[model samples]
Target: MAGRVVPAISLKDYESRREEITKQLVEAAETAGFLTLIDHGITIEEIEAQFALSKAYFDLPKEIKDKVPHNLTTNNGYEYYVRKHFPFLAVLLCPIKGPSTGSIDQKESFWLQRNSEWPSDEDVPTFRAKTLNFIGKCEDISNKVLTCLSIALGFEEDYFCKAMDTHQPDNLSQMRLLHYPASEGAQGTWRAGVHTDIGCLTLLFQRDGEDGLEICPGRESHSSFAVGDTFFPLPAETGPIVVNIGDMLMAWSDDRLKANFHRVRAKESGHSPDRYSIAYFNTGRKDVIMQGPLKKYPAITCNEYFLHHTKIQFGHNAKKKQEAAAAEKPSVVAATA
Candidate 1:
């Protein structure tokens, strides 16, 4: 069914049958890049409250919001009143095109990272308190989601978490808030373009009733998405979050877990105000180069692929070549001298 909408999982069932829930999550992720999580223990009131706060922050005057510009320390954090031009995170989450066409996504998003500095009582005041509370709660939710992922992947619940901690203080996890304004005339421009997430995994909390996210089947032979050539529109559920595998997770899984391509169209509903969603992304440590298992699939370096992707963006083909030469020069000199 190209246009078919699937039913979502029930929270009550999820809570009651923990083992079964874990299996379903594992199978869904292994075959399909995405799954709708129910009984995730997050409440409707909490989702609404987070959305309300996001709206309040976004609704502020553009000038007022622009004070906190995107910073590298924050890594594109706090983008206000604009859609995201850096669609790699979005593209990397899902790769819609077989060969990437380089058409960037057209949605605006705000990025937030964990605060490294101890806040001065007066510097942020109440805002700091609210943000910390919100992020702390969401981080817990994200960790639980990761735990589920561990169970599904046939690994210890702490496997990914502990491996990720190898590069402490600068973990790859991130929180992104999106606002999709109604696009009445824009026929082709999607809220997001077809791409894969660059990191390991992603958990999304979206508005309860609105539906826009669509997923394509996996490209691998065992992929669930391989059943069809068409896209599957995600069914809306009240207060449940959508979980999806990303490139990094796929890398970790030795290509067993697919990071399929997906896209979001501009909201068609005239009645609904702008759509708001908060997504958390997890990443592996920078120092640890990702290497897939050779027993299962061909061995490939995660860091090499990632560096290649980033280098594509920066026009650093020459620099990369030079670095490669430099790396080999020492070995050559050692052999001779």
Candidate 2:
């Protein structure tokens, strides 16, 4: 028989029978570090509408889209028609930069954060209204899922929610709209190079496609499946948003749970069509210390790992940028010559 399908949980079901469901969720997390969630209570119609809006926005002329070019100033908001490798390599908490370290993702991305307060009527008009509604729905799902996480980890219902509350200003949620050009004769590993997410959690809504996603489960030993060294393709399912724990969650769990490493390989040479996916990233509060829950698992802090990795990876990138800048300087070139 084929492998067991990944378990999908509903928030309502979880709440009514928190004890049993929490056990299952925690067990699944410990083993897989990822799970597909169904009946998250978000409707497919809403998801489809959001996708339509994203497509409309992306379809705008590149010149018009450039008005909101991605920049550090607005926390990299509204990336449009941009092609570049992942930024903040060090901050991403990966050993090797990533599968797409040097090469760029074959798609454009747009970023957005949680609005501090509801936007006024005039700023975006219809756009603002739809965005706020979408975000509200997403936030509800996030809160409910997080509550399950608390229960799964044997913490009081409000533990993580309260800690996260203080960092509401830095919710840093992102709505990334990706458009992968038609792969007629593409020569590469995949549309999005192999990489794991950096945030605590990722919620994905992918457009129509038979298959593209792949996962390489973390291995307990050096010798294991070939996917242990590379990404293994995962088939797309009809419902239940694909949810994966990222480096942040692994760190928060104090090694109890792992961050799933996954990647996408381009579709069959002749059959691959353009692909699109919108990912809703739930970035933790900037200053919220992600320590292991009290009286849960071994005592450790996500902050410790974050600082450790950040210092190493981030410092390296900063140095590289500095070196590149120096090399580009006219005076430096003249002196060298």
TM-score of each: 0.73, 0.75
Give the best candidate by lDDT. Answer: 1
* Candidate 1 TM-score, C-alpha based: 0.73
lDDT of each: 0.58, 0.57
Tell me how far the alpha carbon of residue 118 in candidate 1 is from the true structure, in angstroms, after superposition.
12
Model 1 misplacement above 4 A: 1-18, 72-74, 80-104, 116-127, 151-154, 165-167, 221-229, 267-273, 293-307, 310-337
Model 1, residue 35: distance off in Å is 0.8
User: Model 1 Cα displacement at 6 (Å)?
Assistant: 6.0
Model 1 lDDT tens row, 190-287: 66655467677787888866667877865562222232336677855557778787867776776777787677665543433456788877766444
Against the true structure, candidate 2 has what lDDT?
Answer: 0.57
| Pairs that collide, model 2 | 90-314, 213-234, 214-234
